[model samples]
Target: MRLSEYQVRFRTRDLLAISGPDDFILGEGRAVDSSRMFEPDVSPYCFDLANRSLVCVSTADISGATFFYQAQRQYARTVIKVPFESLPDGPASPALIFSIGRCGSTLLVRTLEAAGMRAVSEPDFYRQAACHRPLDISL
Candidate 1:
């Protein structure tokens, strides 16, 4: 989806497109659901937003649009999303992150967590910074 269109869609629907370790999309594929996999796709509810149709290219093709999903849908990338409460203490290694933008940054933090590394994201870096009170006291 085009960034502009995505903006509208995001607002319209409470949906998030995540891509690695605990990827909702990765687990959103037909294969994940044994029953669904057994049953052939009869609805053919594919999302074909290509050919000047506000297409946003990913590694995989998202041919259909749906209201709800049970399986993890495979996408162009991988995402490992852990709830904030589940995330570990901060100080995520800068080197461990390959973040340059919004999505990349989120995936990076998850990657670090999956790798059993202690890290925090740029957004949460302040938490780490704020954790330490000044050694020198001032009025």
Candidate 2:
């Protein structure tokens, strides 16, 4: 099938580029609009970095849009496509990993990210954490 002129032109750059509807859009009312607008949308863009074309479609209503890798149009990679439906009713908090100063915590987190895990590196821990860094670890 053929694509519309707009689709050919403003198919969107990428989710990383879009960040959110707060950024500029390229269409109109009942379409990509003004107003730092954020809404449900179906955007298709090619991912040069991942070396795969992708499609992303979602909204804050049912859920926010997500990048469906052309390789796997079923789930998201970097971030959740939609906000969590609900907090777990049970008391099963996630495990925590605390690293000491300059202990290669970022390297560990980067490795996890490369393995497709949602990870973050917090260098401001010294001022952020309430407890003192433990002095030792077995391994």
Candidate 3:
């Protein structure tokens, strides 16, 4: 489909949730409104850096016990693409959590959510970024 067909108005929060450059693009995406982008079910799947656009996908309500990546692959239907420049500026810094394998990271995230805090589990973009980063960097 044509890129123009997927154009939509992106709110500041939506843009913030999709922050950072995407490592790759997911073809021509589907268009959705701002509210859809606000739901946890809808995620920023990737970016079309060449076109300066952000791609988002719908995976239904994933706030329960569903695995994030599994939900994306299984239920993803609608996708949206918006101009990167149209996104408003967000906070200068972001809160992040890091941990090693089997370190209760998931439990901690759930705990934070239970406490009424917003926390994103494993997001695919982070994995993509890690894969695309230069391997020659010195520690």
Candidate ranking under lDDT, highest first, comes to 3, 2, 1
- TM-score of model 2 relative to the true fold? 0.27
> What lDDT would candidate 2 get against the real structure?
0.31
Candidate structures ordered by TM-score, highest first:
3, 2, 1
lDDT of 1 by residue, 28-98 (tens): 32112212211223111112212211111122322222211212232223222222333235466545443
Per-residue alpha-carbon lDDT of model 3 for 8-111, expressed as tens digits? 22322332243343322345544445455556656766555556676666666665543454444445555566676555476899787777758787898799
Q: For model 2, give the 10-residue run with minimal summed lDDT.
A: 78-87
TM-score per candidate, chains pooled: 0.20, 0.27, 0.63
User: What does the lDDT read for residue 82 in candidate 3?
Assistant: 60
Q: Ten consecutive residues with minimal summed lDDT in candidate 1? A: 1-10
Residue 78, candidate 1: alpha-carbon lDDT = 28
- Which regions of candidate 1 are displaced past 4 Å? 1-98, 124-139
Q: What is the lDDT of residue 112 in candidate 1?
A: 63
lDDT of 2 at 131: 38
Would you list the clashing residue pairs of candidate 2? Answer: 59-63
